[model samples]
Target: MPGSVIGINMNYGYPGQASRHGDEVSRTRPVATTSEKIMFGAPVVQNTDGSVKAWEAASTAANFAGVAMRKVKAAKIYPYQNFGYYGAGEPCDVLLRGGISVVCAWGTPTIGGTVYVRTNVAEEGSPEEAKIGDFGAEDESGNCIALTNAKWSSSKDERNVAELTILTRQGV
Candidate 1:
């Protein structure tokens, strides 16, 4: 007798992907000239002039705009190329209020748990040091700050990606 083989589906969705449709509200904003590369699903804040930049500190949490959304680009020849990020001066679609998939940089995600963004305080020599835009469930060594109106919609999957639902933003 011949052995049978089974196939498995390993399709974890990409970051910044909206879990559902209709209720999502997104706005196009220009990436600030001084902003770093804004990855899809990274938390961002708006400059006084309305340009968007990656979240850098707790003080700017009040200016929290939302997560950078991933838009399909014709130049990306492969599905996994670049891991999806927008360069300075690019037009970025930001999800203001909705369920979005994001990368969990540290800590485990649980449904209904508060969403925290890693700030610049993450220890300079730690793995999270360069994870400024990633999400977490707790303030790791005071390096993360909670997004007041956002929560985890789903636990992180094998790909370290989870669904986050932003209910409201301060100025959105």
Candidate 2:
């Protein structure tokens, strides 16, 4: 019999289940109006109407909400939560500070190094060109994606796994 790997998990833990590291509480938010598609691991913010949208460089720190725990389409239901397998794509259950994510490399990512949210994050590419600290902090000091492990890379074709512990001044 040939050996086979079941699934690809750079890290461990379900969306709501407790992991060895610890259990992180997830909160639900409403989806905001946006043309951009929502994906897992991407940072997000709160709109004036209390809806959640993707977090970008222009997004201010005070408005910093959390990372999208699932894929949210435009014009969906309110109060989203991760209810799928590992919570890949569900809705609003955004993971704010203290949540860990196994993010795909959109740039050359390194362990313990910081990564930023990109609207155009490539499937696999060198993040060297990616801007650092684009999270729109009060000082414009960008929110940082702190890596829990070192999976550094410089190739754009290679898929790099980055474990991120989102670190920002603002919290949910």
Candidate 3:
């Protein structure tokens, strides 16, 4: 399933306690109508007008927004205002941190492995096998963008899905 398939406790924090379970750590922003297919935990970047899109290596730190919180359509208006609409784009709630995201596994992600967004090129040892959006113990290529908060409790298969927490919004 896509990361957009959220649990009932939508705003719950990672390893969230029952007392503060309902608190929202996410923020809402408009997404570009031409934005890429952003899954629940995918990284995104922002435009000068505050419209968000998927994070790419070409973007700088200032363009980095946060993670997608829902499966939003392009050009659909949200309840708040005429903020998101066709040509105007759609609004997507973003989870800056303290939220769980189901991301793709580049390799077997360990409990304490570091999460990174893969570039167009493959990893050093994993030739012909792409390692984009993969979590690993080391970053050899220097092309990996770190998602500092994410961690996996169990190992995941390559190209499989696993849930992780958004610990911080440190863009690299």
Candidate 4:
């Protein structure tokens, strides 16, 4: 056994597989498609009537990121594009991916608080978590390059990217 290298094998489970409101259902962890583009939310098209049209299920998706859980897949958390405050500190969960990625981050404060990801949940701890001010940026929890501060401009009127920002009680 000496001088021999051994491979380590471990069992891993997907994160937060589901939630409970009534019946059981999958919590929305999508897989990466071969196309490299991982689409989320719904189709948003500018209609000929000079209005924005959205094609999505009107439900829980607002609080969750519906993106693939695979590395190399790109994602866009389009819903958080609005801002507000969640007094309960209900977290805005975004997906994570690795490799080349193009992402746009957005969110309105539902309550007077900030945005956190991964172990950053209240019951969870920080230092090894992601935190950012309102209207900031954070990489997908799984594919996080690191626990980044949300990277974006402030005042809701601006859109920049930061390692973190504060979720205030205001809006753009």
Candidate 5:
């Protein structure tokens, strides 16, 4: 007998994972020595010296690099152990143009809507404090900034991960 379907389709993959094969354009770059830990699926920017770093709210659209891609490492032996992030000076793959999954740090993701990045703390001295590089759908005034040439490809799933499509390479 065949199995029965119960629910609607949802994104069930790890962050920074390519939604499909062969359509992504990526480039390898080393993390800047002064850069902080960069999580997979977070947006990045290119420094003047040609190294990559986590994208901050102060960064202009012209400096936008791309989203970081997840790399399989021996340390990440299990799927649940894949929360690791890349440190300074490590080589990372940046998706220049593609469909990739990312976490919606705040705000609901809407298909074909503009993508925003959290620029400031949502609440001071609270666990809900927003971090740089977090994605969202609304601008929230001064707390978030819109990303250029990027859009939400799908709504977020139960895990708050959604598909983001980069239409073109920004700042490069």
Candidate 6:
């Protein structure tokens, strides 16, 4: 999540696929709206020696949100809204994921709240694609939270443990 992905999105920015409020075309931008949401920008490419080097997006996509475009950020979010989907549903809970540090309070997560976590995300879109967005409300109170406090276990201790684990539906 520290780095950025730049590429042409197949879901959006096309002729035949151009339709307002349509999922047929996805948008391409710095994907940050959805937690754990991963999107690969165009492959990084190398120009020297005809090698493909990594390249980030040279431009930004515009959201058609009725709200003042001023509020629309140069970010990866819904096409027509100020706040992008919290992605606080189903598998996208950032706190309960395995790598999240146990310090986070996972019980009773509100609609759009962030719980302190220490989980390592996948290379780019691996975990995001696997993380099915959710749209339910939970109360993060005195409950048995599923904080998989597993320290970084990658060969480089990269904290990729959560990548291999599929989070349960929901828990505190």
lDDT winner among the candidates? 5
* Count of clashes, each model: 0, 8, 5, 33, 0, 22
TM-score of 3: 0.58
Residue 122, candidate 5: C-alpha displacement in angstroms:
4.0
The collision pairs in model 3 are: 75-85, 75-86, 118-132, 118-133, 149-167
lDDT for each residue of candidate 6 in 92-167, tens digit (9 for 90 to 100): 1122122221111122332123321212223553223222111111222221111222121111112211111112
Best by TM-score: 5
lDDT of 1 by residue, 54-87 (tens): 7776544577788888888655446664367888
Error of 1 at 153 (Å): 0.7
**Pairs with steric clashes in candidate 2:** 71-89, 80-92, 80-93, 107-126, 107-127, 108-126, 108-127, 133-142
Task: Supply candidate 4's per-residue lDDT for 158.
Answer: 27
Model 2's alpha-carbon lDDT is 0.43
Q: How close is candidate 2 to the true structure, as a TM-score?
A: 0.51
- Taken over the whole model, the C-alpha lDDT of each candidate is 0.78, 0.43, 0.51, 0.24, 0.80, 0.20
In TM-score terms, candidate 5 sits at 0.86
TM-score of 1: 0.84
Higher-ranked by lDDT: 5 or 6: 5
Q: What's the C-alpha lDDT at position 160 in model 3?
A: 51
Q: Model 3: per-residue lDDT, tens digit, 1-172?
A: 9875875433322211111124336666776877764445556676767777766656543444565664444433456222222222656667665534344445556666766666445444553655443334345465566555555544443335444555556433
Clashes of 3: 5
Q: State residue 54's C-alpha deviation in candidate 4, in Å.
A: 12
Q: How well does each candidate superpose onto the true structure, as a TM-score? A: 0.84, 0.51, 0.58, 0.19, 0.86, 0.15
